[model samples]
Target: MNLSDLRQDDLGLGIGLRTVHFGHILENWPDIDWFEILSENFMHTGGRPMYILDQVAERYPIVMHGVSMNIGSKDPLDLEYMQELKVLRNRCKARFVSDHICWTGVDGTNLHDLLPIPYTEEALKVMAEKVKQVQDILEAPLTLENPSTYLEFAHSEMSEPEFLRQLANETGCGFLMDVNNVFVCASNHGFDAKEYLRQVPWDQVLQFHLAGHSTFETHKLDTHDGPVCDEVWELYRLAHELSGGRSTLMEWDADIPDFDAVHGEALKAREYRQSMSSTSSSLEND
Candidate 1:
């Protein structure tokens, strides 16, 4: 994958479009670069949320990130859901559509969570086929985010980054690299976060996600509730150096804060991005 394959613009420094800040967004229209809409939120509704989304989309560039694609599931693909997703994409004029690289549910039940998939070849083939089918329906590259897992499958054949690389190559799909998820999973699963960054297929990465997570005695939960931690910031630094940066977004889904607070947190990613840019320039000059 090359830069030419990613036709979308890199809309820098965004926050998830959450309802807690809807009034602030519409009234103030803060100086953020873009907003990532949870695609499902606007999918089945024609209510006030949709109205506000219309206003926001008109003002700033929009991207669609969904949780319910169920790309790795054994269940049949939901054609009606895909059609509705595309409708929402067109309605908002989203620059691109993204979902997690995990399955949501199986056997006709909506689990409503991003469930992990094993990293075996069979699982990879299933996900790749599903991803291709989805892209064909949406008529665009379907970007997938790496999920933070609490456990690894025993029969796995590869590392997470390698699996993601294969999936991207096989399906011609894009990636939403979540730096914090890498940190969380690395710490929980005992892997080098920097090594994970090194192995990522940066060329396929279309956007980046930075968020905060909660730490338990035994493991970490990907609860995007507060400011990004320092370790994740350093990992973000590594990722920036590798990918040369991409459209980065901050996610704060739990214990939500005010619009300004969340936007300010999102802006923190800029420090690493800018500093990396300067360092790269200095090296080039040397």
Candidate 2:
């Protein structure tokens, strides 16, 4: 859980590791800061997937972003999955490990989605303790992300930002702030995105995620299927300025476009971050 000297860098931008990019990445090997892997994709592998995984690890740093921790679930920890994660982290030499800050399932069931957690002290305590234990067991500091939540609990006691800040303060963990998630949640919950950024513990934020989302008539969902929206771009600007432009990633999962097309989006994220830096310098000199 030692983050005092954790090295942070804005490696420009990187897209989610998809199969389409494997050959080009391995043969041509485009220059990238790193690749973020969906842990479950390679969870049961021994063929081409694992081979490409190792090759990519050799080329660029890989970060593990998972969805099945269920850290906030009422059920007990999944020790088997934890062991598997440790093995994968070692194999990939991931820079860090991360997962959504909510439950995935309960009662030995797999809901296959990132669900919400009540913002109560009890839930906070449950999540923090479990996270601390996970970190200790994994021998690495866990990075919990504020997921895109579609609903709220009636018994919630604190705001989303408060819950995230408390998680860092109470559990000695790091954060992967997803700018797209914040925008979606704010629109759904009707909170101010800029205000949310101001409340975040930026020092504890090690990385940032930028992704595209689709909008429903009622709310914006984190579908990550289309181009990054202009509105989310604005919110990303705020997050970059607030978090000092922490390491950013471009994520597109479903209906993934061509490899070059996805990486093209990542390049766009780097451009946005460059603008944020210039703006910061101007304001400081004033």
All-Cα superposition RMSD per candidate: 1.5, 1.7
lDDT against the true structure, each candidate: 0.90, 0.86
Local accuracy of candidate 1 as per-residue lDDT tens digits, 1-286: 2334563467889999999899888889899999999999998899999999999999999989999999999887899999999999998898879999899899989999998899999999999999989988888889899888888989999999999989988988999999999999999999999999999998889899999999999999999998999999999988888988789999999999898899999888888989988998999999
Expressed as tens digits, the lDDT of each residue in 140-173 for candidate 2 is 7898899999999999999988898898889778
Candidate 2 to truth, TM = 0.95
Checking candidate 2 for backbone clashes, the offending pairs are: none
Q: State every prediction's TM-score relative to the real structure.
A: 0.97, 0.95
Q: Where is model 1 more than 4 Å wrong at Cα?
A: 1-8
Best by lDDT: 1
User: By summed lDDT, which 10 consecutive residues of candidate 1 come out lowest?
Assistant: 1-10
Error of 2 at 100 (Å): 0.4
Cα misplacement distance, residue 41 of candidate 1 (Å): 0.7
The residue-level lDDT of candidate 2 at 87 comes to 94
